[model samples]
Target chain A: MASPGPHSRFSARVGGTPASISEAAGQVMAIAEAHGYDKAARFAVRLAVEEALTNALRHGHKGLDPGTPVALDVEMLPDAMRIVVEDQGPGFDPAGVPDPTLDENLNRPCGRGLMLIRAYMTEVRHNQRGNRIEMTYQRPAP
Target chain B: MPSPESRLRVSQDAGVTLVEFVDRNILDEANIQQIGEEISGIIETRPQPRLLISFANVDHLSSAALGTLITINNKVRNKGGQLRLANIDPQIYDVFVITRLNKLFNIHADTSAAMSSFQ
Candidate 1:
């Protein structure tokens, strides 16, 4: 399928892991503001994007060469903003994640990222490539 | 990079207290706890217990950060006040919603609205 139109109406690109994650987030907020999203909605989008990017950077590219690239794509519509984060690394099983809220895992430092991603976005899915993930934010009713 | 430190600013009229985080990485769980302990200290002292976090300088956040916010919100609510959020960077906000926290806290567009929420 063809990509969404330039006016349909959002997009951005970033290279590398850490900086790419930050830039991806900045792009999402800029798009939200341009579309006049409410504060709560904007916050939700930002958090979801951050978690996805962090996963890409931390887990996806944990020990890869620093030269490896991570890419972020964002599209904003009238009612929602969709984000995609792709990385160059071996993908892992999303199903194997432990429950973050469990008492045994509560004090652990890193398990909650995926849990937070699932909680905030209206939809969260991983692509077959395993290194690519997509998330969406729906505009809350006024 | 600046070392992690916690700062608190009070806004009584808005019934919201703003906690600004200047940390190496808000994504770190230990940093989240340090920040949370400071905010909790403030809430423990306040008679009304209202809060609105302004994460203006915070660049990133992790699930621990989200949990810290939730814990603060519960503390404030138990005291008959509310915990809201403002000036959150998009990166951190995304985590908030992805974790379904947007549904739990009264996040505002700016400090003004978050403060006014208690009225």
Candidate 2:
């Protein structure tokens, strides 16, 4: 087995069963806190992570069998934290998501996560298949 | 339905039911469900359910929590009642803004303001 590096590292495979997002978020938050993320930063990371996982579960895995795997990887670096959430289901187009902030869609609940993820994270990117999302949050300078 | 043991505090002011969520952070899915059920119960039992959910101490909420609030809001309106929110943290309020729930619910700066608006 390869030895783990000095930097903080976390990896988990969350089962696709119902209500797994909460558990995934909890674990991510714990890892963030362990690396000295402040309350606000932790909150942002937690929210973004939850939304990403939920999207994977709700949109990516639709019509698929339960127990599909949602892979999680977290790397705490000196300047930032990087997280990758990937699912085994079909991907989506990030740009095609409607703007929830528009007057017509203001009352609707859709697109909230997309907005939040963009707002909180320093950078957010999706794989070509759209089934995988990568989010990065820059650690606040002391 | 969420049981009384959920530790949700209830108070009345200006005929408005102010629900103080015990969990300072409404992130867990189970907690979100419990709060949703509690709000639903309030909507069903209150003759004129003008509710003001106080998030004074709550600093964090998940998207599922947002969905729960939407469901409760619909139930309150369908029951011929009203639902508002007050004392939400700025960060949490931003969630409402991003989700555009700010336009859907009557949000107040504080519980006092929310109560007065109901009068």
Best by TM-score: 2
lDDT for each residue of candidate 2 in A1-142, tens digit (9 for 90 to 100): 1122344887877776435666667777777777778888988898888888877877888888767878888888888999999989889999999886788866554467777899899999999998999999998788
The 10-residue segment of model 1 chain B with minimum total lDDT is B1-10
List candidate 2 segments past 4 Å from native: A1-6, A17-20
Which pairs of residues have clashing backbones in candidate 2? none
Model 2 per-residue lDDT at B113: 81
lDDT of 1 at B93: 70
Q: Model 1: how far is B108 from its true place, Å?
A: 20
What is the alpha-carbon lDDT for the whole of candidate 1?
0.69
Per candidate, the number of residue pairs that clash is 20, 0
Error at A70, model 1, angstroms:
1.3
Looking at model 1, residue B63 earns an lDDT score of 68
Candidate 1 lDDT tens digits, A1-142? 1233434445544445455555557666776776788767766677677777767766798898766666777777678778888888889789888876665554344567777777778998997768888888888877
> What DockQ score does model 2 reach against the true complex?
0.52
